[model samples]
Target: MRIIGGKNALDASSVHPEAYPVVEKILQATTSTLAELMGNNSKIHSLNAKDFVDEQFGLPTVNDIFKEFRKTGA
Candidate 1:
């Protein structure tokens, strides 16, 4: 679900709002946009979640972000 009045950025995934920054970091590291990444396990498999880990979002959260991107829908 998306936050009202927000950009509806998380509208299509199971990812938590707190993890958006992690997602952004992942997107920046990859060649694809969010649209291109979603549900594409081929792309997701190439990602190394450890590279995106931060103080707030650790390995588990980063892995979850990877899983969320592989989902076909919310």
Candidate 2:
């Protein structure tokens, strides 16, 4: 992964390719649930991204992810 920020501006890190599927699944599930909840609704003009993510995805933390990984022996 590449990260760009601050004075240093850029940095790269490595991640296992196997992790991609897990991340993709999380994103797909989040977006699908969000769409279902927002179906036929046009009044959401001021929803905060953070709040929306939290509400829709339950704001999963590192510990939660780790717990899931352990549960699945991943």
Candidate 3:
């Protein structure tokens, strides 16, 4: 579900070809990080979607995207 969302978002963004790998890496890392955080936590049933987004925002992919944007002025 998350991967599908990520891919859709990426597709909609029209990011540069060179940044595709970076974006994909970020998506994978974000998924794993969230999985690890949720691991074996039976008591945890609900989570704020914003919190997951906040975590992903801190990933290096954000910086990579910015750099790509700067390079291309896109």
Q: Could you say which candidate leads in lDDT?
A: 1
Q: Rank the candidates by lDDT, best first.
A: 1, 3, 2
C-alpha local distance difference test of each model: 0.80, 0.33, 0.40
For 1-74, candidate 2 gives per-residue lDDT tens digits of 54444232112222234343433454354563322323222322222234423423443432243233323112
Give per-model TM-scores: 0.82, 0.26, 0.31
TM-score of 3: 0.31
Q: For candidate 1, write residues 1-74 as lDDT tens digits.
A: 65544565465566887788888888889967888888889989998988998788899998888887777753
Candidate 3 Cα errors over 4 Å, as ranges: 1-11, 32-74
Clashes of each: 0, 0, 0
Better of 1 and 3 by TM-score: 1
Relative to the unseen true structure, what is the Cα RMSD of model 3? 12.6
Q: lDDT of candidate 1?
A: 0.80
Q: Model 3: per-residue lDDT, tens digit, 16-71?
A: 44455654554464553322422223312232223323433544545445333333
lDDT of 2: 0.33
Candidate 2 lowest-lDDT run of ten: 6-15
